[model samples]
Target: MAITPNYYETLYITRPDIQEEDLAKIQQKLQDSISSNEGEIIKADKWAERNLAYEIQDHKKGTYYILVFKALPNASKEVEKHLQFYRTDILRFITLKTTEEAVNKNKASEEKKEKTEPTTPTPPPAAPPTTTAAPTPPPAAPEPPTAAPEPPPAAPEPPTAAPEPAATPPTEAPASTEEAKTENTDTQEEGGTN
Candidate 1:
């Protein structure tokens, strides 16, 4: 039967006072153990040193390292056996079976962190040119002034009030055409007789 490998994550803490060389040696030993057990490591990184929740082996602070690998269950047990017995610098350790999805999620989060981390300083924006004034020219000879052109005449002002209308006698119009003709005939007859 084909054996299915299982993913595992191991978080191990070391003494805060451990030397760099000693720490590297300790890491190398664990890695060697994992490899010998036919396990393949996916990620191995050191976490920041910090105060521990509770002292282990009288250590209030420790340096943490994480190791994620895929291997047969028997192979993982072999690796853990080495950690539990052979290693002395390790103050505490925990190994847990994990899903491939969790491993991918962790990988993505680490990539995101690296991308957001600041890089080398960028050059500042180019500065504007300096403001020192250029050399002034020598004074020139003054010329005689000529007559200035006059502006066009202004438009006439508008009248303030309109003129009063001419006076005329008020006359009533006849109510009908027949009435108007009778009045005109009477006036003409009167004029003729006079």
Candidate 2:
């Protein structure tokens, strides 16, 4: 049986606090592991730090790295095992087989778009007339006849009390304290007689 090389993409996140030197070391180790397993790396890129959709291992953000390579099916397992050994450094990881045809298609489409797109620089706006002409004063309108100054406004009167609202008849009058007590005694007496 002939072994076929499969294209795979691995996306992994490292702890946010990892130093640049340590990060580079991790990347080197991953690349070495892939090469040792007879895998060829197509791209290894750091996608920069991003906020996680949800916290992982107390991490609110992590540095993302993607590795696209061609390897045997078993090589993916080996790579994943190697990454698992460095659990403390990595927050999460996922490896998936991808079709080379899809990648090629995307590249061709991007190239086509670039070729079809126009790159004309926008022309700067036309400048205003350089010659400064003296502005003419607007024609003066006829002046209105002057009137004697009116006396100052008189002091405002104090506000009157608000009108009382109309009283609506109550459905039932409240019983006085004495009446309530008598009613309570009558109920008690009736209960006793019963």
**Candidate 1: where is the Cα deviation over 4 Å?**
119-194
- Supply the TM-score for candidate 2: 0.56
The whole-model lDDT of each prediction reads: 0.67, 0.69
In the order shown, what is each candidate's alpha-carbon RMSD?
A: 27.1, 21.0
Task: Please provide, for model 2 over 137-174, each residue's C-alpha lDDT reduced to its tens digit, 9 standing for 90 to 100.
Answer: 23333222112111111111111211111111122212
Which 10 consecutive positions of candidate 2 have the poorest summed lDDT? 148-157
